[model samples]
Target: MSVKNKVAIAGVGSSRVGKVPDRTGLGLAAEAAKRAVEDAGIGWDEIDGLLTAYSMTEKYFMLGSVMCEYLGVRPKYAASMVVGGATPGVMLNHAAMAIAAGECSTVLIVIGENRKTGQTRDEAVAALTTVGHPNFENPYGPPMPALYGLVAQRHMYEFGTTSEHLASVAVTARYHASLNPEAQMRTPITVDDVLDSKMIAEPLHLLDCCLISDAAGAIIVTSAERARQLTTSPVYLRGISEFHTHEHVSMAGDLTHTGAEVSGRAAYEMAGVVPGDFDMAMLYDCFTIVPLIELEELGFVARGEAGEFFAEGRARLGGQLPVNTHGGMLSHAHAGAAGGLFDIIEASRQLRGECGERQVNGAELAVVHVEGGVLSSHCTLVLSNSR
Candidate 1:
């Protein structure tokens, strides 16, 4: 039996990002879900599978059930996942499998959060900091920024990567954001601006981190056979893989190397494509150093060379391989864990030539990578315009 089954994304949608204090998390999700269902040209009754991700601010354990009731959907198969940042991409993999297994024909994947409006700054910090091991790590009270700062510090010490290299990632993402009207931070910035930003943690300035906002995104998955009957620009899921190396940052075998190394290899092998085959990459950029580390792990550039890759403008819009055309988490919007779903939506639109100014010319193949829990859990998806 072939490992790569035929599943395609028929439609994708996202709610208005940034601070929208008027809506709850469920409201944001419902808005995006409605758009996705409409875009797919399928009625709500056709959806037989539903998947959702956890929200730190929302105290709902049965989020899948709650979302179903809000959206008026009763799916035969329902699941809620909590894989941190990897939720979106991992959900895509699961939804695809369910469709391929004949368990469902249409699946809806939704994720969002009202982090900015729902939780105070202190509350948000406290909640995210708990991702670390309570007994061994959380007692020290290392915030997410500090944990990633340690990773950045280690990368610089071992590979001679400087703050300028990290700044380049921020600059590139901001440049892309300037083209995207829906992006949170649309103002273009330079490396000097990134360097001048306030320091959040050692080796990580404010710009080095992602923006916080209230946002939600969704996508509809169905069989490739069904997709042909729906949209003319269906984006096929050519390859997908996910893995977790550790639950906490302290448990990671190595701070510099993430699960992207393993997941990227598996996804590429299943897709029968190399890193160079992709026209663009929508990499998860929760922190600036993340993309550099993931680029190296995914074999797009040699270890320690990712610094030079970004410094030389290789990651810019018209560079060798455009990355994060929708500006990514850094400059776009990070609504709790739902940030990863934005990457998938942007990639699907790019494949369909829907990204106007930021579009990569002749883009047929693209890669979407999302990581969860301080770079512990990883998911990679290879999408193509042609089946």
Candidate 2:
């Protein structure tokens, strides 16, 4: 059964992002959860279900139970979900389904990590590459940047997407971050600056990569009927869908054409809205090319034209459709799995008109899309303030 308008986000919260060496992953999660409960005007005891994304920096095996013990919360339903970067979106889907199935109500979703301060630079890089195929991709010793670089290179070759177009994405993200007080990198950058930045992987500059950060984010979801009693500005889950293409980049069927094509179509169909129905978007920006490719795959822009769409200032604030209004992973904090959770939080805040300087005007609808494991898994969510 379609979950359209059945589940609604009642509240959202996030911890101090960027670098925080003092707090543990569980500590961050607790802080964010408390804030979320407060934002929803509900007591901690009201949360019957809890869902958390697995922590890569932390060594805890049963992170869900560990977090429950740490927070003094005895949830009837709990789980530690792992789907790479797609965990947050996937978890949201599961939360909605569980609530619909009468398993529990008032679910709290949280994720956090201290990757920036907890791990050495080498360790951080190594963690990203561990997802590579053990036999074929791992033997080559390619880091995450190299994997995304290959995708960027392929897009350029096939669609005439230029380096300047990639730089535009970074520049836009930085500009948005400048308006976000919680963003990691707030300094506005130029396309030339991105072009001149040190190269990590060929054709992909350091600016093209997302930041490693220590951060946490949380969201509270409940049945739509219950959401109205909790908050007047509830963001309803209008559409949600997920698609898995492969585990590794090498196994992907097509480099440019991602599973977003299928997932986006399904989500739109479920929501009964097209791409034009969205007032804003929160496309995952793990790399510069990701959102550009997603825009095409999600039908936001014509294929082979996303590069121009971004380069022409159409994706920025006051443009046709503002994207990544909270700076996104490119300039915002990206704390492992929490990076995608931040996307959902930002979209909810935008719909609620809570964003101070970076708010999208009259944002009634938003589309949030995230991919994991070298674009191997995809999930798309369409959120709205109205039913």
Candidate 3:
């Protein structure tokens, strides 16, 4: 029997994914959690396993216990996942196998963070290393921008990529975000505006970085048979993969390339599809450089061709493969940079014909990529309109 026993994402739900001072982390989770259950046509008591990312927050709360108290169901399998941003995508894969193995009937996966009202962008980056190793990279006091800047510099040097190309990614994503009212940064910007923006680090401008906002998102997944009985448009889980280059950005394997090179290949091989086969894609855009690097690694373009690839306006709106149509983390807000879930949710919306204006026409197949920890880890997922 295949471990991938034909699982499907029955429902996906998210709370207001922006800076809202009205709710706590648990409150946000509850908002998203209720919508997901309603979307799935299930109840709180139906979920057997409760999977959450970062159960221990700065406030130090237990996710499983908290969720149980809020939802009023003590789960059979309850634990917090700490695999960084890749936790949600990878843990979703784990949830599929668990259901196939008859270990659980229904699974709930959630990622929520309250950074907007709590900490500023600079303040959030400072706390990342408290749980990381301080012996080597942390002591340098290098923030995520510095680590990601290293990759941007290498790409510019290797692929002849320009600062203008990076600015284009920012400019376009913000345009899409303007179409999304739920996005944190809804203002539209131009490439010229991005180029003129203030510099955070060398080759990384203020517009190049994703926004830090407070929000939460959740999804309800069940067995394929159950999904068929529940929803008319049961979006299938085609393939999933995860990879890590290194914990600390300083010791990364390659500056120009990323672990997405490996993880992307794994996703294609497992899903039985090529990069060109995808109708749409959601490349994680924590920084402008991430999607550029991932595009090359995923074979959408050549290794040194991402610059030209992006410059052609091919990845923008009405392009061949319109990417991050819901604005992505660039304009969508990065809740601990796990904002990648919004990408996944948007893709699902496009596939299900929910996104009215930003929807890609006939989006039968799509990809959602989420990353966290400054290029240290990534999760790649392929979703298709049914088998």
Candidate 4:
């Protein structure tokens, strides 16, 4: 029943991100998938299972099948999940479980989207705002930023977290992105720069918001035993867990406390490790406040202490725990559900020592956490280089 070290990530790949105007979502996915298959040193026919995340800009109903056809891989098991940002993590869990259950082997998980260039700004804003409850929450016409702004406001009021603390998160992300050659916004930014940026919502500025970019990422997962034959350096899935709190932000029990508390605890328990065991973390940074809150919920810091944790440069590279080393959604590309998939890819690369400058030295263990639907659904995954 325990899936600990039962599955391992053999390879990972990503398409050119940020303002990709020429390729459709599926095209990006195919590119990433082909690269993943190649990275794994396996033929396309070896992929017995396929999983994909739904596209916000694309109108395809059976995206999994569509991607299968586009990639020319007839997978025995295929599914397309739509869980917002958490879809990638959820899909990884499914792939591991399916492989463990003997339903399939060599599963390929891919997601892609052209959110930046495929859709108009107004259209994208309109689509995101639809997450609000039609009867109660949608009538006021609150966009996604407004919903997260409420949480940031509440955290500030409850824990005395200041706007400067939130800005520190943005500053750290930009710093990491500056070292990444493929990042969309590589320009370094300071906390002062973040605070001075145009305010999108109260306590949240333009720099605090995650960028809208086109991207695609793919990862290949197989049984641990099979993984060793495929790649000498496979990232093992040490533990994985998911928790659902609510559908809409209004239905959330606590604004500051999220499902990450429950899922993170479960994942650590499953992995037989604690927060200190992790060398790095890739938390969902849809906004600056998200990772700050997640750091507390994931037991990296005590409640009301995450603000100082980031302010002290504890989450930056060469710090105690380098977080979002690939810059995350804040500065890296965030292409719909594919955004979170990048976290998994980054973790695997860090473990493999593939990241050149921004790599965390001797990264043996990592924790990747992602949430969807305004922090409604959460999935926590613990990955390690050693089984």
lDDT of 4 by residue, 303-362 (tens): 989989999999999999998998999998898888899999999999999999998999
The model with the greatest lDDT is 4
State each model's C-alpha RMSD to the native.
Answer: 1.0, 0.8, 2.0, 0.8
Q: Rank the candidates by lDDT, best first.
A: 4, 2, 1, 3
TM-score of 1: 0.98
Question: Of the pair 2 and 3, which is ahead by TM-score?
Answer: 2
Candidate 2 structure quality by residue, lDDT tens digits, 273-321: 9999899989999999999999999999888899999999999999988
Across residues 28-102, which tens digit of lDDT does each residue of candidate 1 receive? 998899999999999999999999999876788898998888899999999899898899998999888888888
Worst 10 residues of 2 by lDDT: 122-131
Pairs that clash in candidate 4 = none
Instruction: Look at candidate 2 and tell me the lDDT of residue 259.
Output: 91
lDDT of 1 at 111: 92
Query: Per-model C-alpha lDDT, please?
Result: 0.91, 0.92, 0.79, 0.93
